[model samples]
Target: MGKSDCSKLHIAMFPWAAYGHFIPFLHLSNKLAQKGHKISFLLPRGVQPKLENLNQFPSLIQFFPLLLPCVDGLPPGAETTSVVPLNQQKYLAFAVDQTRDQVESIFKVIKPDIVMYDFWFWIPDLARQLGIRPITYVVVSSMSAAYNTTMITKETTVEEAMELPPGYPSSTVRFKDEEAPIVLSMARDFGSGLTFYQRINTTFTQSDAIAFRTCREIEGPFLDFVAQGFRKPVLLSGPSFPETKTKQLDDKWVNWLSKFEPGSVVFCSFGSQSELQKDEFHFQELVLGFELCGLPFLVALKPPQGCSTVEEALPEGFEERVKGRGLVYGGWVPQELLLHHPNIGCFVNHCGYGTMWEFLLTDCQIVLIPEIGDQILNTRLMVNELKIGVEVERGKNRQVSKESLSEAIKFVMDKDNETANKLRANRAKLKQTLSNRDVQEKYINSFIQALQDLVKK
Candidate 1:
């Protein structure tokens, strides 16, 4: 099948009930739609309003709402992981899984050519029952995906998982024993006596192929390893890098960043998934860090619900002291767009896969300060494997100190620094690699062709 063969295909997308998962699937849907294919994007009611570009291609893209099922301990408004607190995530996962019947009903009505899903472990079986083949779409680094699939399914002791996989490069990058249980716990057995790992293994096994939100150039080895280990076709769908258009920054932000030279400001954000501890010590440390680094910084942070202003969240006179040196905007800011701005030099990011792609596509120096979950592994890819970024040193408790943060900022943004120059050069090459429209199209077309072939069989 050629590129034109995909025009008649109808693709149904159901991502895990998390913004991180949903957004990537949406990007793929848009790509497929642009090629004249039909896309039915399944979104829970609560998250529908948060989606952008609904009217961009009204005819090709359609939203199909799946009402979140009621489950004990899951709040009514909590449909996406962004809204749910971290501690109660298990309940949210359980609730999302209960939507299986609703999904099946929708599939019967739509009768899609193929169904693509992320982290919905039950999707493969459901698609089979409905006479439609399912494809597992993983929105993570290929190594992380392969590691989880391999380690989680097999009943290996934590000690066994500590050692780096035999063929992987760098023995220093092995998983810590303490991190294994938390990773495994995220994969609830759901009465199947299998960890979340087994569920994913089974799902991927049932599918003819697995689709990843990554390209082969950066992770060719891990991709090959997963395919060989699992004995299934592994397909790359390309990195869904953001399409950056010059967006006008707010006057306040623009005015502050104007004082700094091009590539001198550090943009720090921890995304919506995690938050800095709302305490005097942590807040004071960040202020001191920025001051010591002497780099003008823009931080996007949301104060806790009870706090009315950024001042209430920070230490006394903190804002006054750093008035000209930095910015602390409460709530939203256009992050990807800001990264494209000439004045912004460095990004202190949480290392979410989505954010990682944004950082990769831009010239901004990366200073990874990952908070939780897969971000730690994502950091490893950036700092250890790719060698495009530096990670800040954290204390034994994983709390980063002001001194360490300051040093990291200086290491990346300092003009005469050799290591910093090399990182920028590597990042420029990566940006060029990711910018090839033909390369992206080729990957998407190949993925579509594979889907077409799967459906035909």
Candidate 2:
């Protein structure tokens, strides 16, 4: 009933149990740590060990592991989404949903000034019950939030789901006919008797304030649309990634990349979650596209489904043909560092939010082949709105053709291509703005002030 008083807020960070979600929350926590805020970074017990190496300010950002509740179909030790296949990820979601009790217990102990979370929609109610503010921090672009992300129920028609929300900012953000179903699919039953739509819609509507890892300069209209729709304070984190102060690319990567001439190597990485099925013709098309392009490439992706190893899945003589110039390995590679490598001329990717921003900051030319729903929207933003990249054309059934992939890469790589030249100029300007410290600090500062103001409200 009264204006709350606080200083140096102790915020609890509970992200979705996925590397993509966890890493961005940590990046924000790292930024907040610099401002002297204490963070209680909560995650599954098994995942803490993996994140320890990444915690830059372990002293200030403490890890408080939660005992992950097991689900019937989930694997014995599977704590994150990475261990689960795409079809079976609902089991992982069910497991995460069961953590509300555990989360509430910890919240009672910490009595954090705020609970910053994503995916766990129940957080708002729990935070309110404990008299702690809950902040729903979306790591994805606001454009996706405004255009593609909203309340689409199982009962919602395909046509309705395809239609943009009322007063949505951009007409340019249209989904393809084949891509329209993705919105409905995202909204379908994920787990815990809730669709992803209901989970996000509830959180967005109920959270004390909403935050995004975005800025007003580029995503201003979409951000405004979200604010208007939710009728809450929408704060921006401004793409504040953890500073890689002393980190360097591994020697093996450095040495291998050095062999290629500057601005010659094509780096292909489809995030941690992507795995083309061995049976799918596109998997072969993907590698063959690299061969067809005749460019030096390094692909970092999981081995396809039904295959135990990346080597086993390769087409006949495929490895031999591209042996010396190209490499396709499924292992942890430092993508952020590699993006800045001298030889990385072009980056072919799936356009995950974190990856998109990371690649945008680099001099590497972008060639997008987005697979998932959000990735498709991100690709549209890059190719259609920002004009920063070219997307590989997909067939009616969303199948990737080797010719299309090769053509997209070649188009961007062409020295004298007009469209490529335009993309380069636009991207250069954007790179300057995005990488500017002052612009970024202004957004983060505003976000902090908004949080403090919310306490007063």
Candidate 3:
């Protein structure tokens, strides 16, 4: 079979419908395709057209668009998590669970050597029946994954998880008292006939091996902990870096950015997930923070909840007060790609795991303001553990004030200050480590070799 030639093996990938999971799976598929392996990428029908431009190796990687079946409680035409809000996303997952037969049919026909997936815990059992290996690949850090898996079992209580487990890899990794409810929410039924906790636990327990989009350099201790705890091989695919081919920035952005001095503009983005509610002590204050910082800034966010447009949500005279120096666009932009611009010296973001890897590779000073979930933990990894950034200070109730947010931005931007210099120097060192092409190559190559050995077994 294809096991004889690992380079020519066929693989299939099915990630959770969210962009956070889907994009990283595609990026991994692209890496495999570059090494002469073929990928059958299965995603929702509508999402296919959206991700067309990112399919750099179209000839070697084919997209099989599956129409998500309808489920009760899910709104009409809502297939992905991005379309439906978090609370209603359980219905979307219910619809995905209904696709089991369709997925099995495709697997039987393709007979892939290995199948990789994030959610859908039933996948490992299905692959075994079809005599194919199944690997659960997570996009989150091993630190997050290991900690969550240990502390969030099916029998876990909200009160129990509020305290750190008896023995964790790092004491630096902690859950806040106020964050207990959000953490406990994982136990809620997610409509896939499983709670979020059960689904994740089952995936790890059933999969032949677990893989992560991380390197030992960044998460060595946590990786070891996961391997020992799960009693399975843990493969590292390393971090995905920007490829040589780059997307051209728009003329308007180029012209505007060129007018500013090098390393002077603040580029703000919160990924493609949330439309921040204006009153969560998030949107308006964050907008005013950039204004208060007096930096030339570009903030790309959806119009806040309760407002029809970004212009409508701004504080009184906010538009006029920072007329030429600021912008708050209500649409998606190439903000991640723009990190290369010399004029973009500061990055303000939610510290998303994938985005953290991205910003870590760039020279821009990081300022974090995580909204919810593991993002807060990722911020701790950045601000406390790595010491490569500063976080916007949170109050007793975890709310961030305009002045505190502004101070975090200004702290990173102060080039002459000793603390700022240390942050930059630490960031530069980490960037060099991640940017080591040889190191990254070995991780991917070793990952593929692990798959071949598993198939042979």
The estimated TM-scores of all candidates read 0.92, 0.96, 0.96
- On residues 308-409, what C-alpha lDDT tens digit does candidate 2 reach at each position? 888888889998888789999988788888999988999999999999889888998999988777888888888888889988998868888889999989
Candidate RMSDs in order: 2.6, 2.7, 2.1
Candidate 2 lDDT for residue 357: 86
TM-score attained by model 1 = 0.92
Model 3, 1-457: lDDT tens digits are 2445544778999999888888899989888888888999988888999887888899989988888887888888886888898888888888888888989999999999999998888899999999988999999878777766653655677778776545567787677778887787776788766888778878888999999999887778778988888899999898865475657888988988887899999999998887887976778988998999989999999998889998889889999998888989988888766888889999999998889988998899999888767787788777777789988888977888889988988888998889999999999999998888988888888888888788889
On residues 1-457, what C-alpha lDDT tens digit does candidate 1 reach at each position? 3464444788898887888888888888877777788988888886777785532567888888888777777777788888777766667767777788888888999999888886677787788888887888889777776665555444556666555665664454445554665565655553234556665667777776788999987888788888877788888889865454446777866777789899889898878766556653365577568777887888887674457766677766777877888788777888877888899999987799889888888889999877654787888878877789998887765667889999999988877999889988988998898899888879888877777777888
Show the colliding residue pairs in model 1: none
Clash number for each model? 0, 0, 0
Give the distance in Å from residue 91's predicted Cα in candidate 3 to where it truly belongs: 1.2
The whole-model C-alpha lDDT of candidate 2 against the native structure comes to 0.85
Quote the lDDT for 289 in model 2: 90
